[model samples]
Every structure is written in C-alpha cells, then in structure tokens.
Target: MTDAATRLATLAEEALGAPLPLRIRAWDRSETGPPGTPVLILRNRRALRRMLWKPGELGLARAWVAGDLEIEGDLYEALDQLAGLLWERDDEPAAGRPARLVTAWKAARDPRVRHAVRDLVALAGPGLPPAPPREEAGSTRGPLHTLRRDKQAISHHYDVGNDFYELVLGPSMVYSCAYWDRPDAALEDAQHAKLDLVCRKLALEPGQRLLDVGCGWGSMVLHAARAYGVRAVGITLSEEQASYARKRIADAGLTEKVEIRVQDYREIDDGPYDAISSIGMAEHVGSVRYAEYTGILHRLLAPGGRLLNHQIARRPEPDEEAYHVDEFIDRYVFPDGELAPVGRTVSQLEEAGFEVRDVEAIREHYALTLRRWVANLERSWPEAVRLTSPGRARVWRLYMAACALSFERNRIGVNQILAVRTPEGGASGLPLRTRDWRG
Candidate 1:
C-alpha cells in the first residue's frame, strides 16, 4: 500500500480500536482491511480530504454523493456495522474539550492536514454545495410553515418526477407506512391493505365526503372513491402531483367522484368533511405548528367526523424531551421536517378538542416499507437516474436505507392515530370493534 493509504488504514484501526469491519480500496488501487468485507473504495484524494475536514456523517455523505466514494457491497449492513462501532466508541470517555482542541491544532499543522484544511476553509464553510448537482439540498425560503414556504418545501420533494416516484413506490403509489398482513406480503398488496385500513377506520359509506390532507398522487382518495363510494377531495402542494393524480383519477373513471387540487392544507376552506386522512405529512409540519395543524383539521371535520393522522414519530428516552435527526437530512432530504414524540403528538390532538381513540405504532411496517422502496430504487437505478439527477437519486437511496435502519432499531416510529370530533353527547361514529378492512 502507498504510505498515505497505509496511514489512513492505521488511523481507522486506531480510531475503532480494531481492524476495520469493511475493506478500503484507495484511489491508487491499494487495499486494506479484511478481504471479504464490504469494500469502501475511495475514488480520489478529495474523498479522504472531505472526511477529515468535516469529520462526521455529513462529510461521508458528501463524499458518497459527489461520487468520490463508493461502496461495493450491502450498504445497509455496512452502515449498521459502522454505526455500532461509532456508538461504542462514543460511549467511551474521551479527553476534555480543551485537550481535544489542542490535539486537533497540533494535528492541523501536518502538511497533509494543512492542505485539506486550507482547501476546505477556502470554500467558505463546511456545508456542501447547493444541491441538484452534487446533492438534493433544499433551498426553500420565506417563513417556516407558511403557505408559500410549505408549497416550496413540498414542491421541492414531491416534484422530483412522477416516473421516478413510480419506480420507487411501485404500482400502488402509496408513500406512507404500509400495513403488511403477512411478513412476506408483497409491497403492492400491503399498500392496498394500508389504504383500506384507513378507509375502514373512517367507516366510509356511500355519499360521504372525505378530505385527504397532504395527499400524494391521490392513493387514499382514489381507493376511497373507487371502493368505499366516497366523494373524495385530495389536496397537494406539488403541481406535478396534482396533475398526475388528476390523470390517474380520470383514467380510473372516477373523475366525477374525486377531485385533486394543487393547494395547501391551510388554503382549503370548503370543508366540514365527514372524514380526513393526513398520511405521512405530519413530519413536515414543524412542532411549532402542530397545534395550528390539529386545529385546522378539527375545524374542517364535521361533528362526529373521524380524522386518521398517520405520521412518523420519534422514540425518545423515558426522560428525554427532545429528538433530532442528522443535519444532513435537514439539508438534503426532508428540509424543515420535525418528528415530534408520540406523546406530544397525542397531546396536540387532544388539545385541539378531538377525542383520541387509538394510536397504533407500526414502526416495523415502516422499516419494511422503506426496504421495499430501497430495493425498487436499486432495481431501477438506471431508469431512476434518467428520470432525475444522479444527486437526487443518491439522496433517496441513502436517506431511505438509513431511515429503514433507524426504524428497525426503534430510533424512530410510525403511528396511525385515530381521533374524532364529537359533538355534545354525540358518538364518535366508529364501530366499537376494529373491523378487518383487508377482508
């Protein structure tokens, strides 16, 4: 191995206190670590420079997204092993901050270190380049959660391309946590089951009005209108999604029964619907606006109407009051997205004057859902890259796989909460027993 490559291998071994779990192949074709392990190939010196300068997940992510780094084996498994080692290393006590700073200063003076540091500093900060080229970084402006900003955020994410989403989401086009009847159920079937589950929970009957807030491509609305005979109105911020949904609804011959609008949830005024379903959209609603969101839903639903709020929640420690995702996600994936604890979400629901009837945690289902998406993306990688930029494709691949790992580890959760706006002495309009919607 070259001297630089050898030094890097030695540094990694010392940092982890063991031989690296994965093999490393430097740009010069020099290899290190076990032969059979997943291989992390550094394409150039810039890869190592990026990692050393930023020194965390963001750095590694930038290297991967920039095509400076590539993994030759199971990415998820590699990440798992790396994460375990990092966690274990973090748990061990380290030198004080001042001592670490002094060490860093001393190391910064080395020729290789100085070169990387100068290059990184010359770029004017640690942040990655603005996205759509090397990354899919979100650049939304305006006040957070405002109608305009929400539209910007939603459009940036969902407007990537319909064909691209189809490759990832499959034929069902359901983007939320699917309800898997069996551990081996197909993704399409599971997605259908999840849609029907929401409809059954709403107890839709003929001629009832259903408002699907933050609906993506009208999966739930289409299912409800076609199967449950409900008049459904699905709203989304992405014009692309609304256009595609309208086409799908018309093609399905449900044009008369379903309406797809390019409108924000906060902009919908004609409401008092019998039921509302907010699937996979609450994460985008910052915690600061949780109350406003729940209140808006409450105002829209008629008395005795049901609201099915499906969202991703954070699983915090018993005494912890906060949960946060990585900075990379905030920039590249779901910008301004916030995952509130289930307790806080339920409290918001109750405080909005709705009776919280049920809160079902289905985190494992989400893990399955994300894995299926990652598999689909991998299978259609070439087509996905054709439909969107390479950077955007990489964003989805990395974020979804990482999120699947997080869900499996109980670091996050997906919950379907059923609430009802009950009038004085009125029933919740739900059956006492949960019906088998899959039937």
Candidate 2:
C-alpha cells in the first residue's frame, strides 16, 4: 500500500478498533483491506478530506450524496458495518481527562501525525468544493404548527411527484403502518388489513359519516366507503395528493360517497361526523400542537363517536438526546416533524375530553412495512431514478432502512389509540368485550 493508504488504514484501526469490513480504494489506485470484501471507492482526495473536515455521519453522507464516494456491492451491508463501528466506539469507556490530554500532546508532537494533519487541512481549505444543492431539502420558514407552515412541510414531503411515490409504495398506495396477519402475506393484502382494522375499530354503520384527516392517496376513504358503506371526507395539504385522490375516487365510482379536499384540519367547520381517523399524520403536528389536534378531532366527532389515532411515537430512552434521529430526517425528509411518547399522546387525548379505550403497539409491523417499502424501491430502482434525482432516491433508501432498523431495535414505536367522545354521565359507547370488533 502507498503511504496515504497505510495512514488511512492505521487511522481506521485506531478509531474503530479494527479495519473496516469493506476494502477502501483511494483516488491514486492505492488499495487497503481485504481484496474480496465490498469496495468503497473514493473518487478524489476531497472525499477523504471531507471526512476529516466534518468527521462523522454527516460528512460521510455529504460525500456519498455529492458523488465523491461510491459503494459497490450491498449498500445495506455497508451501512450496517458503518453503524456497528460507531456503536462499538461509543460503547468503549472514556479515558480520564489527564490521559486524553497526554495522548493529545503525544499525537501533536509526532512528526508523521503533524505532516498528515497539515496535508488534510490544506486539502480541505477554502478551495474545497461547495456542497451540492439539496433540492430535496425541506423548508425552514414560519412557526411550527401554523396552517401555512404545516402546508409547506407536508407539501415538501408528499409533493415529490405521485409517480415517484407509486414506484416506492406499490399499488395499495398506503403510506401508514400496515397490519400483516401472516408472515408471508403480500404488501397489498397487509395494507388492506390495516385499513379494515381501522374501520373495524371505529365501528362504522351503514350511513354514518367518516372523516379521515391527513389522508394520503384516499386509501382509507375508499376502503371505508366501499367496505363499510360510509360517506367519507378526506383532507390533505398537498395539492398533488388532493388531485390524485380525487381522480382515484372518480375512477372507483365513489365520487358521491367520498370527497377529497385540500384543506387544513384546523379550518374545518363542518363537523359532527360519526367517526374520525387520523393516520400517520400526527408526527407532523408538533408536541406543542398535539393537544390542539386531539381537541379538533374530539370536536369533529359526534358524542359517543369513536376516533382512531394512528401515529409513530418515540420510545423512552435513558439518554433522550442520544436517541434523536430527527436531525437528519428534519433536513432531508420531514421538516419540523416531532414524535412524542405514547404516554404523552394518550394524555393529550384524555385532556381533550376523549376517553381512551385502547392503545395497540404495532412496532414490529412498521419494521415489516418499511422493509417491504425498501424492497419495492430496490425492485423499481430504475423507474425511481428516472422519476427523481439519484440523491433523492438514496435519501429514501437510507432513511427507510435506518427506520426499519430503529423499529426492530425497539428504539421507536407506532401505535393505534382508540378513543371515544363520551357525553356527560354517559358510557363510552364501546362494547364491553373486545371480540365484538374482531369479526
């Protein structure tokens, strides 16, 4: 190996306690690590210089997105290995202050270390290339939960082209956590089951009216209208979603039974609906506005009417700050999105005068759902790339995979909370036995 390759290898060993599972090939054709392993090719010196300049996951992600670094072979495995190395490093006990100072003094005095540091500094100096434009980045304007800003955030994510979403989400077009009755069930079947599950939990009657807040692609609205014989009204902030959902309702011949509106929940004055369903949209409602959201749902539903809220929640961790994965998501994916704990969600519902009936944790089901989405995206990679930029595709791939891992590890949770608006001195209107809804 050349001196540069050798130095990198040594740095890897020192930092990660072992050489990387993949081989690293520098710009000069200098190679290190095992030949048969997966290859991580650095296109130019800027790649290494970027790593030294920012020195963490962000730097690596920037390099990969900017086309300075390329990974050959399994992309998932490469990310897994990278995460494992970071986990191991964090698990190591920290040295005392004096010991760290002594080590730093020794490193600063080493002639080879000095020279290497100077070379990296010069490479990453003012002449470094500017960061590529993040066309997919979300908006950072206005207050968190205002009607205007919420629309902007929702549009930033869901308006990325219906064709692109179709490529990733499959035919069912369900964007929420699916209910997989069996391990080998198909994606469409699982999504159907999830929609039926929500309808069942709400116990819709033949002529009752149902409102679906933040409905994506009108899946729930169509399902309720077709299967449960209910008049459904679905609302969303994305004009693209509203347009596509209307066309779908028209094609399904449910235009009279189902309605899609590009309206905000806060502005809805027509209410007294028999039932309401809010799925996968509460995360965008900041914790500060969670009470207001639940209050709105409570007011919209008729007395004794059921409200089913399905949302993703963050699991309680000892070091709360350490479990924050929203930094990357807020920048590249869902801007201003916040997840509250399940307990907090329940409390908000109760505070809004809704009696909480049931809270079902479907964490593993979301893991399965995300895994299927990643598989679908991989299968349609060519179409996906044609519809969107390569960097945008990579963002979805990495974000979805990481979320699946997070769900599998119990770092986060998805829950369906069943609540009811109870009249004064009245019962909850739910059946005494849970088996009544199972059928």
Candidate 3:
C-alpha cells in the first residue's frame, strides 16, 4: 500500500486538477515530494475532514487555525505557490479555461470528480464536523455597522491583549502603515515618520485641536502633542487600547494635551476640530456607512481644516457587485471589515463636502510594514503564543504574511487621501506650492 503522503498528493492533484505545490508530510510520519521545498504538515485525518466539509479557503484556514496544517519551510514561498489556486485575481466571470470554482461546482456531475470525493472521504475517515477554534469570531451577530455591532467588531480585532500587540507592533504600537524612507528603515523610525507625515499634511499648528478617529493605543495623539504642540482627542472602541493609551499619555506628561476615550466616533459631541486623521480605520466602517462616516468627519472639522484619510483599498471589480470579503479575513482577522476602491473612497469624501486635495498610493510601504510585523511576531513567537493563544499567533502570522504578498502583488493597496473642507471662497488651506507627503 502507498504511504499517506503519496496517497494525499495523488488524491489532491486528481480532485483539484493541479499539482500539489507544497511537500506533504502525513500523520503517519510519511513524507512525499522533492527535498528543500516547504513541507506541509497534515497532522491528522481531521485536517482532511476540514477540507472535505468546507472545501475551500475557509477549510484550509480552519485546518491551519486548528494547528492541523502547518508549513515547515519558507512561508511566503508556500503561500506564493498556493495563491493562484486560492485567490483568483480575475473578477470577470469569463474563464477561457475552466476555473477551479466552476470545476468544483461541476464535481457532482463529473464522474472523475465523484470518484475523487469518494476517495477523499475514505482518506479523511469518519468524523463529525470539527468546531472552529475559540479564536474565530462567529458570523455577524447584528445589523452590519450598527453602533453596538461596530463596537463588537472593533473589540474582536483590537481586544486581543496589549502585551501581544506591543510584541507585534513594537514600541511604536502603531497599527497603520509606516512611512519608510527605505525598504530597510527601523520600524520605530518609519512609524514616527508616518505620524509626522500626517501632521505635516494636516498642517498642524501650535494649539490646534486634532481628532484622530480609530486611534490605536493613542500613538497619533501622543506624537502630535509632543512634536507638533497640538491638543488632540483620540477615540477607540477597545477598552484595552484606551487603558494602554491613557497610561502612555500620563507617563509622557502629555495628559493635558491629549484625551483618550473608549468611545465611538459617532458619539463625539464636541467637534470643529482643526484637523482629523482616520488612518487604517475606515476599512471597518463598511461601505454602507462610508458616506455617513465621511460626513461625520467633515461635520466634525472646522472650515478649512484638513482630513487625512488613510485606508486600504482593493482592486475595482468589473461588476463591482461581484466583490466580496475574504472569508479568512472576515472570520479570523478583521470581523465585518470591508474595503472599497480608492476612487470610490475619494468620491465619497467629495460627496461629503470635502475638496479632495491629494491622493497618494503608497502600496509598497504597507508590504514592508507587514513584513516587519511578521518578523516581530516570529521573533517573539513563544511569548506571543503565551500572551495570546497558539491559534491567535498563527492567525497573525498567516494574515500578515498573506497581506504582505497581497500588497507586493498590487492585489490591494493603501492610500492616503488628503482632503479639506473649503470655505465659501473655495480657498483651500494648502500652500500654493505642492508639498510632498511622502518622505
């Protein structure tokens, strides 16, 4: 009889109609495929059962999260090899050749596929459906983007422990994209540069009031207060963030200059802030509430005040309506989060009564940032697993690595859109000369 790894490889190639890219190491200590390749560790039959039950990206994600599927070599290479099989870049329905999705859907009717599934069932053995790991979030509990639901969504992602975050995010504790002078800049320095870049774009002046929406751990508020002499209000839904930020503020003796609130952006009553920064936050706003989110910030800012909106955007789909959230991201990393095209983001800001000034696409910066983050997590792997769970650590590692690849390939991008609420004279506060935001 053939070993499990050989059987697995044969079965997978036959069912998917493609070669298995990664080397296979089965539970029986049997291995197959060439040397020096990434070995995919399939710990047990349950891993196969996961694939059989869900039969797509979610299935793979489940097995990975459950510590059943693991890679023993270069993770990026493994992901790169699997990308074409998993994430199809083409949005058009027309596939000149039969796509994996079409092939899977026709599996029942096709005799070859039916035989493959029967073999897969025998290989997977008998088992009830495995429960998802405790780290995974359930499906959206309430109406999307409601005040309560938003809080829950925010908490799900952000409440994963400040210690763990500090390890992953480093001393900066800034979760957004960093402005890298070069590809190899220090993480802290790059993060500082990014904060300063935002302040310059907003033209922060002495005693100006700034509002930072979705501020993570008060990095922006503290930086602005210390460096630019701005009084700032930073708000987030995560209590852990608020607590961590408040302590940082007090320690820095900037308590008087900055306020950290565990409050939703919608609940902010006092407004007319001189400037606003919503970095890496609007993706959580959901497309349905995007207009409202932009309107809120526009209303909150005084006339001639600048708004720096930093967000991640996906490639525009041909049908637009054909776009959907990645199942792994929605379920594991960012619950109920959504991304829009950069053009759509600019249009919505313009519609909300803001004159969009500059749109900078710093796609490569994010790829670098994510790689640094992955390095941080991998460096502190044991501590990270101790602080969070092994499952959560794995989630971070996979998502960050995958996202880094996404950024590098331009499958998605991060943009900084600087807009302003122009007064009646239509005079924007920006200088006559062009200011380079990327430094």
Give Cα-based local distance difference scores for all models.
0.80, 0.80, 0.89
Q: In model 2, where is the ten-residue run with the lowest total lDDT? A: 95-104
List candidate 2 segments past 4 Å from native. Answer: 1-5, 16-22, 34-38, 84-126, 136-139, 317-325, 435-439
Model 2 TM-score, all chains together: 0.87
Please name the candidate that would achieve the greatest TM-score relative to the true structure.
Answer: 3
- What's the residue-level lDDT of 118 in candidate 3? 85
Cα lDDT tens digits for candidate 2, 1-439? 3555555656555433345677887777777887766778888778876666555565666677667888887776666556544331232234211112113224556665566456555544455654643744644666678888888888878999999998889999999999998767998999999999999999987899999999999999999999989999999999999999999999999998999999999989999999999999899898768888898989999998999999999866566566554545776789889988899899999999999989999999999999999999999988888898788788788789878887886768999999989988887777788646742
What's the residue-level lDDT of 144 in candidate 1?
Answer: 79
lDDT tens per residue, model 1, 251-332: 9999999999887778889989999999999999897788999999999999999999999987555545544456668777
* TM-score, model 3 to reference: 0.96
Pitting candidate 2 against candidate 3, the one with the higher TM-score is 3
Per-candidate clashes, comma-separated = 0, 0, 0
- What are the runs in model 3 whose C-alpha is more than 4 Å off? 88-107, 437-439
| Candidate 1 Cα outliers beyond 4 Å, as residue runs | 1-3, 16-18, 85-133, 138-142, 317-323, 435-439
